[model samples]
Target: MVVFDRADDTLRHLARYWGTFRQMGDPKRSPAIAALEAVLYEGRAARIHVIYDGPTTVGGRLIPGAREQFSTGILARASAGTWQRLAPKADPAPKSSPLPGRVHVVQDGDTHPAQAVLMTDAEVADWLTATAAGET
Candidate 1:
């Protein structure tokens, strides 16, 4: 159970997990989600738990004496500066990358391209804004 600081990170994580699942032939098993559900259901009675600052708890014990653990990789923190840096800017449109869209979205979790990419720039911007706000 990896905890992210914002909705963007959560979306990125979902993308990465999906990419790996796809690359691995979309296994008939999903241990990660299973484990997460187990802990979530079983730990509901426990009070001692660690949490990542995000829309929900990344991983933690719902109760004491439960040995549940969640593993997460590096997740970028959400900050105004970070968002500004990652957000696509407007103006004299900067040089765009030549990489195919598939290559970019599969690279990491929260950084994956949004579904609204084909929509208007304002729509895309609004999506990012909405996601960022929801995350915090």
Candidate 2:
């Protein structure tokens, strides 16, 4: 993972807030590619956690019948298996092992209490655990 500012007082923001993830025009410089690179580099096999109401993908044009937007189409294919997975059931026990290419979308203020804005790998892991355990 790219450690932009590890210091505690630097007003840390999640990876989604990074400007590079919200850029436009160049597919080579697409935010999805950057995110996939980071995730691939981490190799944690953990689910991705997206911050709600945060910096989102900028609007882009998509040709009719195209499955994806122009800028992200290629990257989406490149990261095909790294989208998201179904939430584990909230009964019995939820799997705790790291699930590669799994993504969990959480709102900043979700109905189920969660540690919003995961800023570190540890935090993300913890949140994933809580989710697995149906604690959030």
Clashes of each: 7, 0
> Every model's Cα RMSD, please?
18.1, 15.2
lDDT of 2 by residue, 61-97 (tens): 1122222111121011112122221112212222232
User: Where is the poorest 10-residue window by lDDT in model 1?
Assistant: 101-110
Query: Candidate 2 versus the native: TM-score?
Result: 0.19
As a TM-score, model 1 comes out at 0.25
Clashing pairs in 2: none
Q: Using lDDT, give the best candidate's number.
A: 1
Per-residue lDDT for 24-103 in model 1, tens only? Answer: 45643344544544554544455423344443323321222222232221123334443333332311222334443321
Query: Candidate 1, 111: how far from true, in Å?
Result: 34
Model 1 residue pairs with clashes: 12-109, 12-110, 13-109, 13-110, 43-62, 46-62, 46-63
State the lDDT at 103 in candidate 1: 18
